[model samples]
Target: MHDVVVAGAGPVGLFVACELALSGCSVLVLERDRDPRPPLKALPLGLRGLNAGSAETFYRRGLLEATMQASGAEAQEVGADPEAVEAPGPRALSHFAGMTLNAADVDTAALPYRLPSPAMEGFMTSLDAVTSVLTERASALGVEIVRDAPVTAVSQDDEGTVITAGGRQYRSRWLVGCDGGRSAVRRLAGFAFEGTEPLFTGYVAEVVLADPDQLPIGFHLTDSGMYLRTPFPGHLGLMDFDGGTFDRSQPLTREHLQAVLRRVSGVDVTLDEVRLASSFTDRAMQATTYRMGRVLLAGDAAHIHSPLGGQGLNLGVGDAMNLGWKLAATVRATAPDGLLDTYTTERHPVGAAVLDWSRAQVATMNPGPNAPALRKLVHDLMRTTDGTTQVYRQTSGLFAHYDLGDGSTLVGRSAPDFRFEDGTRLGDLLHNGRGVALDFTEGRALDGTAQRWAGRIAYAAGPVRNNLGFTALLIRPDGVVAWDAAHTPDRHAFERAAHQWFGAPSRLTTGAPSL
Candidate 1:
């Protein structure tokens, strides 16, 4: 029997399996698709944006460099030579409901908590590149992935969970469904998925245009719906608010696409060839709970919303990172009581926030009478420092914080990539997939406490370029700050936090003190 059985080999499943395997758990990943490469996973159609939090998570696992390289980015220049200077260029802008906001307009000074780092705030990459990088990493970590194995049924009891796929039964201590939005595992497991219905059916396609010049580059809002023509000669995207009436199950033909484009763009553009076509909807839904008995859900299997701001991939990856370590600990029987429960409690809110964000964008994009005015207001607001800061923070995933009963400002937030005096950054310490007790003061109190959980929690004492008002911090394996102190050290609170996160010190380790 496998320690964990993960259904679907998408980025989320691969990431979770990698995490489990990294901690010495036997992971078996079952993928429904036989082939890994698909046109939709390539560039132009499969483009996705990785926010700061997602990028940081990749960096923690030492996969960020590989992902950036696979995306054809100048990976060496990203953090290799900080002193290298380059020519100035136009600021990158992020869009909301097709409205763009220049990064330069946002005041970085307002976000004093954010530490300077070589990692980017965000970047664009394709699904293929992400999956490739994660697959390689998962393989390197000793994870077994089987293709053409789709889970047809799921059954769980107190002993374990049984999964039937491709006429074979597999047993595992735990199961996770990382399948797409139309998740069969979720249905078979009887999860309650609830959310708002779609307001429109969106189309994304690559085509050969006979009269490409007829359509201008960039986005267009029309009375019928919205449309976008990319710089790529024949690439087009369209939104039809017909209450999702278009038959998505049917293949999109040249004639059908031309008609939809004409109706949405109000242009008689001719499509000579339809290279590839796919459909999506604003139908947002999320499981009331992420887990049901021995089975759990992650990525699109747990929640799904419109790809308005490209938050779906990032949100899904975040879910995997948040759940991976907790689940691994639970499987190993080393986790404290209620550790696995926090996965749903913490991630459910983030998923809900993203859904709401997508809904807000849909509201602004509606062709209703008030939508134009509201869009105008948002556009004008984005031009201001405060507005740009708020939008940047939200879209970049920097604004996400768990309610861990705030004491220090850093508590319950992602730990900053603080550059230490010895040329090491906080992200460097998380490569081993363990919690960290960072002591900026090099004080003996926290150091001695961390010694008890030495193998479980790495203790790093050093001075940083900027501590951000934090003297010490306890960061979870997911890079979230579990606890922090401003100035004075609290041994009792530090010990309690160590127990809460890493569990009591290993009894087998000699010289381990009682918490």
Candidate 2:
């Protein structure tokens, strides 16, 4: 029996499986799709953005370079100098209701604790690029992936979960549903999915335009709806304020797509052929909770929203990153009390925020007299330095803060990549998928105390290129800082923080001293 059975071989499930297998948990991934490399996941139509947050996650896992190369990202565009001490200003930013923000306008000095790293900006990548990199990593970590195995039934008891897939049954200690919005595991497991309905039906397609010149490129917001034409040939996106009543199950033909294009774009554009097409709505919904006994949900299984703000993929990546390590610890029976529960508590809010962000984008672009005024106001505001910075924080996939209940705001945030005098960075330490104890104290103050956690936490101490005023920090496996010290490091407080997150420390190999 596997330690974990993950549904869907998409990025999230594969990532979670990789995290588990990396930490010594046996993982089996079941994918419903037969083809490993689906055609739609290639190039133009399949293109997606990997926000800086997702970029950081790939960096933490040592997959950033490969994924970047595969996605054709230039080194300098998404990277920073290795010897630098400060993080570069935002290199890229997303849009709000088709209104783009200029990254140059962001006030970088206002953002604190950011240090230089190779991955400082969001990387534009495709689903295939991401999955290829993750699949290779998952394979290296000994994760077994079974294709064409759709999870049809799920049953769980106090001991383990039974998953019926591909006409067979498998037993596992835990089950994670990483499937898409129409997740079978979530439905079969009976998790409550609740959220606001959609406002419009959105269409994305690759078509052979007979009169392409009639429609210009880039985001075009009309009185009817919004339509985006990418620089890539034949790529088109449409947001029709049709109350999301279009039956998405129907195949999108040339006739139907041309009508949508004409109505939304207000251009008499003719489509000769529709190569590939898919429809979505801003229908936002999230599982009430992320876990149900032995069965847990991650990625789209947990929450789903429109791609307008381009937060869907990034949010799923965040879910995998947040849940992977905790679920691994739970499978190993090394988790602290209520560690798994924190996944829902922490990620649910982030998901909800993304959903609302999507809904707001729809409202801002909806066909109404107030929309033009709202667009004008939002456009003017987004052109400001402060507005650009706020938008960057909201959409860059960085700056995710969990309320760890610590009074200090620094504790619950993502740790900056602290560079040691020896040239190692925090991202380098996290490549092994273990929590790290970074002690900037000159005398190795945390060296002795950190050993109590031993294999559960890796310890590093020394002078850093820039400590950002932190003397020491305890970072969770997911790179969230559980504790930090501004003054001389305290052993008791460090121990308490470690215990709170990593459970009780093990007896020191040199023989644990009596408390």
Candidate 3:
């Protein structure tokens, strides 16, 4: 029996399995898909939050960065490897399309960030690269990933959870459903997913343009649709689509791709090499709950939305990172059972927010009668510096702020990255553990308190960059500051919060001290 059995091997499931295994929990992942494939929805890694910069702190778990680097290297070898003779595809053209990334728009200092050449264009890679790397990592971490296991049923008892597929039953103290939106585990758990269904269908095709120069880095020819031409190691990334009705009964055809490009771009283009194409509908749905008994849900199984901003994969990957630690701590007997509840509280709103934002993005592209006027107004607004900045920030997932409940100063606000007296930045400190409490000002010296909750919390003295007047601050695992007290905090107040947040302040006394 595994400590936790994860259903599905998409980015989320794999990520969660990686985290759990890293945290020293035994994990088993079951995936139905053969592997990642070309024309797969997930595009190149953003590397936006690699350093946990001003973004929502989603991609800071460090696994994606490693995966991205390895993938890029493999792709580079595919294109530059002396043994290979095949030329890269058209997607490679957008490499020098001169893409622009405005740091100021992200509420950060104006600094230039170059999109990697391998990521922009070079070699062609499929989703297999991502899964393969993750699978290898999981295996190294002692995770057992079983493929072709299409789970059909899930049963939970007071003792644990049982999952059955192909007449094989696996039992575990906990069950994690990393499955996709149409999750069988969700159905078996009787969880209700509440949200809107997709009304529009999008057709996507992978092609090698005969003349890649025709494609720009990124351009929206029609307000209702866009023609994004990005470059990969050896090929160009060309995606053009607008909302349309869906007829899944009919296979997507090359003629349909030509018609859409012609109608939207007003250009008749022939496909140099039509590698892969498919039609997909967008839906905005989130589970009513994240857990049932010993069973838990993460990633697409918990929430799903339109891929307007390429947030589907990012969000799923973030979900895994968020849940992995909390669940590991609980199973390891370090965290209180109530700690698991915070996962839903913190992530549910995030999922809902994604749906809301992605819905608006899709709405802007709705090709209705009002589309022309709406498009004009949007264009006029976006032309402004302020509007352009706002749109850029919002669409890039840099402005998502979680409401950690109204309590004290900076409870919910994302903690501003600050420098410590020792010259350490908050982002630098987060690499160690969940959150830290830094008391630059003279607060109640957590003398015995330091020994109390050692592993879970840390206290250090430093000069905060913001000068927000908060002497003491409580940070969350995701690097968001939950509570800040400019003045010395009351010992009782801090203890009460510690009890509530981590559960059982008394445990701190008996547990091992944190680093």
Candidate 4:
């Protein structure tokens, strides 16, 4: 039996597969579609932004350059100067309800624990680019990906789960659902999906406009609704306050799109032909819990929200990053007590926050007498330094704080990419998919203490270029700071933290404890 059977072949599922396989767990990925590279995946043609946090995740896996290349992004645009002592202010910015922010307004000094690294700022890329890169990596890691296999039923016992997909039965120790918003696994597994209903129906389409100049480019909020026109020819995004009554299951007729477009844009726009189209609602929902017996959920399967603020892709990526190692450890029989449960405890809040963020934007953009006033106030606020910083913190995919309980300012946050004197970086050390105990003590304070966890954790002793007032720190395989020795190298505290996350150090004979 395989260690894990992952549902969905999208970025999250493939990424989880890669992570499990990296740690020596056999992973089988079942995809619902026959061809993974469907052209429609590139719909909404504009590049999807991978926030700094996601970029760092890619860097940890040594896939940053490949991802950037696939996305047609420049190496210089994706990160800061390698030899710099401090991180630069973010250069990329995200929009809230089509109202964009200026990156220059972000207050860099207010941000904490940021160190100069190759992956600093967010960049624009398509889903196709991301999926292709992950698929190649998953293949190299020996992950089995079977396409045209939609999961039909799921049954689990104390030992493992029997997944019925593609008219075949497969058994695995664990199962992870990374399917999209309408997740079959989620339905079959009987998880509660609860959320607020949408107030409007949103549409994105590529059409043949007879007179494109009739409507100027950029976001236009009308008395009726909101419509956005990108610089790309024929690209259009529309939001109509229809209370989400449009039948999404039915084919998107050109007449209906034109009528909705006219209602929202307040312009008599003519659509000669609609080459492609898709519909969505601001209806945000999330699974009450991520786990059900030996089966679990990740990505959209666990939480789903509108594509507003473009958090869907990034959020799913974060879920995969956080869940991958823990699940791998569980499959290997090396996970600490209750390690698997932490996946939902940590990620659920993040997902909820994103859903609320999306809802907030929708609220502001909702067409009504109060909308103009709301949008004006928000626009004014967003122009300020603090507001810009908050937006950057909210959307950049970095700055997510998982309360690891003790509340050390740095613990539970993404570890800084500490650089060694000889030029090796923490990102370099993390490429092997193992916990890292980076010690900057003069006498190697953590040397012997970290040795007991030898195979489970890689021990590195040296003064980094920027320790950020830390003498030593333990980073989980997912690059999250589990503990840090700020005042002194406290062996006992370090070991306790290690045990909490990495499970009783000592080579963890229970299958190498790769988490």
Candidate 5:
């Protein structure tokens, strides 16, 4: 039996499978679609924004370089000019609703905890590139992927779970549903998904426009609805606030798309040929809980929201990163008593916040009379330094933190990618999918404690000029700071944290515990 059976082969599922395999768990991924490449996955239509947290997750796994390399030619085109110095002003990396915030207006000094790292705060990439990179990584890690296999049913007993897909049965110690928002596994597992319904039906389409100049080249908020036209010829996005009456299950016709575009933009935009079309809604929903017995949910299966701010992909990836190691430890019988449960507790709040963020954007985007004033206020605020900084931090996922309950300031925050005096970076140490106890004061107290959990936690001694007011830090496998000590080492406190996350020393075996 496989250790884990992952439903869906999207970026999230592939990522989770890679994480499990990296930790020596046997993983099998089932995907409903046979072809990995699709026209809709290309640029313009498949554009996805990668925030700092998401980029850091990929970088920590030693996957970012390869992923970027896969798109090397494109990267070079977008790469910053070595000789060009950025001017002082707002540099917009992304938008909230349709309102863009400039980076120059943001005060980086305000984010004291942020450190210099190779990961960019935000970058635009294609879904095809991300999926290709993740798929290659998963395959290299020994993950078995079966396509054209849609999970139909899932049942679990005390021993494990039995999954039926494509008329075949597979047994696994655990099952995870990463299949998109309409998750079959989640339905079969009886998860309680609750959230607001859609306010509008959004469309992304690539077509041949007879009169491109008729539509503006940016987002426009009209009386009837909203529409966006990109620099790319024939590409358009529209949102009709029709209470989501459009049937997404049916094939979109050229005539229907043209009608929606004309009505939304208040312009007669002619569509000659339709290449591809897809629809989405602002219907946000989240599973009440992420786990049920031996079956679990991640990615869109766990939570879903509108594509506003491009937070959906990043949020889903974060879920996979948080759940992967914890679930792997549980399957291998090395997890602490409540390790697996923490996944839901920590991620649920994050998901809820993203949903609310989407809702807030939709509120501001409404064509109602009150919306214009609200939008004006938001636009004016975004022009200020503090307002821009706040938006940047939130949209870039830099301000995301868990409530680890009053310890060090670093606790429950992403570990600052510290560069030690020895030229070793914290991210380099995390590539192995292990926790780290980094001591900058050359004290043996934290090292000795970390040694007790040898294979699970890596202990490093190094000196760094920027201490961020911390002498030592305990970083979790997912690069979250589990515990930290300021100025002096706290053996007792550090030991307790180590036990809480890595289990007590007495419970673990030497030389990487076996399953």
Candidate 6:
């Protein structure tokens, strides 16, 4: 029995076992952290994990610039306007993963460049060459990946999911944990992840500066709390605050991170070694529920916060690309368990609004007694432009939206960027495992709902080149739109939440001719 096992190979359980072995689904992937080593899981860390949806969910299908030129990862033109940095203009300006905390104030052009800046604060050799081109394209998309198999028990009901592993049993019909954040499949699928851990525990490093101007790309230094310092194509990175529960017996030393990078960059640098060192603690947890039936839960096993607004590996690769095409269209039965229950109804209110913006950025970096007048009123509202577009709408995961109700005009918004009479760019024609249908001239009438969801809806239409209104906007397979007309009604509504959040409409069970 094997359709989807995927417990953990990290990087959201190896991209959800490379998207359930490219949706054919035979997948195994266990990994308790066996020999598979390389640049310590190819150097990924900083602004927060998995830079939101790992390069626009693998840049729709170019597999994020062919896995950063097959992980040799050395592309440095470093932004200034390559046609407003590749046209879509709103959030696309990276300086090799460095100067991008608030992103000079939002407008990621159109997201998904991967790196120039903000892989949780930069310098990870193009995020270990884009996670070694997504672990060599998830092992050429067949995805068996075992690696030491550290599961202990698992078991399931309704006849399928069993696991074990020190003896090896491994059966499966469904089970996706993406195990991390102490999740043993959300603790044997009993569920309840809850929140708040981290009295304070940070300490990170990656030094290599003799005179890289001794550090001053994005600099930050606090009395006893913060100490950031950015920029990293060659080197010059730091992230201090090594005393919360950080005691490898007073560890966090290369002489205490070169004396906190010479007391926050006054200069005096020499710690060229110490490639990586971690000590995290700031989980706001969340899996109170992500699904229990077939045993599902995703990335960081469905939420764990306090990497602050680096949104923890881009919210665990946006919950492993929104639970990998709704669990590969519900294991190809062709969707409808209310589209796998709208992936916990649109990612648990965006993981409780990123755990209330990482506990209000740790109570404005804690110090108490009006914490330096609330950190000078949040550094004058993150140095305004509406607090740098609300800190790039809380660290450029582009404020995940979805209410999916009403006549549905891009349901609860965030689906703009159409422009394709032929020039193309409905985000490069819905980025790959396609399923778009934004008509708008309003004449396609879903082409009979696209031949009643034939081969899972791919039909595209015209109009709305950033007029930013909605004529039509279907979009799913984890991009999120799930129907639109301008939106309205949804008090537990159901009919076509755009074919129930993009897969799972044509169903049946016993009368049985669905698919």
Candidate with more favorable, higher TM-score: 3 or 4: 4
What's the lDDT of the predicted structure labeled candidate 2? 0.89
- After superposing candidate 4 on the true structure, give the runs of residues whose Cα lies further than 4 Å from its correct spot: 43-46, 507-515
Q: After superposition, how far is residue 407 of candidate 4 from its true place, in Å?
A: 2.0
Report, for every candidate in turn, its global Cα lDDT versus the true structure. Answer: 0.84, 0.89, 0.60, 0.87, 0.83, 0.60
For model 4, residues 1-515, the per-residue Cα lDDT tens digits are 99899999988899889888999999999999998887667745634778888999999999999989888787447777978999899987888778888999999999989998899977878888899999999999999999999999999999999999999999999999998899999999999999999888888888999999998999888888888888778989888888888839567999999999998888899999999888888889999999999988999898878788789888999999899999888877778999999999999999999999999998888877787888899999988999989999999887999988977888889998899888889998888789999888777877777877877788888777888898889999989999998877888998898889878766432222111
For 1-515, candidate 2 gives per-residue lDDT tens digits of 99999999988889999999989999999999999999788878789999988999999989899999889885547768777777889877898889888889999888988888877888778999889988999999999999989998999999999999999999999999999999999999999999989888888899999988888888999999989999889999998888889848577888988999999888788899898998889888999999999999998889988898778889999999999999999988889999999999999999999988888888888888788889898889889999889889899877989999998757889889988877888999999899999888767778768888898998888789888888999999989999999999899999999999899888674322211
Could you say which candidate leads in TM-score? 2
Candidate 2's C-alpha runs over 4 A off are 509-515
The residue pairs found clashing in candidate 5 are 89-104, 90-104, 91-102, 91-103, 91-104
Candidate 6 lDDT over 1-515, as tens digits, reads 88888887766777777776766778888878666654444544433233433555665554655654544443632122322212333433222112233455654453432222111122123334555566777888777778778888887888679989756889998888877777887887789878775656655566565666655566354554554554544333443444345524465667776776675455666676666665566647788779888888886777876555456666777778778877887787777657777778878888788788877777666544666887776777666656666655566564566665544434554454455544455556554555666665434444445444545656665554343445555667555666555433221332365556545444322211211
69-114: candidate 1 lDDT, tens digit per residue: 8988754333423432221211354678888777788776666566
lDDT of residue 214 for candidate 5: 85
Tell me the deviation in Å of residue 281 in model 6. Answer: 5.4
lDDT of 5 at 256: 92
TM-score of each: 0.95, 0.97, 0.78, 0.96, 0.94, 0.34
2 against 5, candidate with superior TM-score? 2
The deviation in Å at residue 70 for candidate 5 is: 3.1
Mind giving the per-residue lDDT tens digits that candidate 3 earns over 97-186? 112333333322221211111112222223456566677777888888787788898898988888997568999989999888889889
How many clashing pairs does model 5 include?
5
Candidate 5 residue-wise lDDT at 464: 66
* CA lDDT for candidate 5: 0.83
What lDDT is obtained when candidate 1 is compared to the true structure?
Answer: 0.84
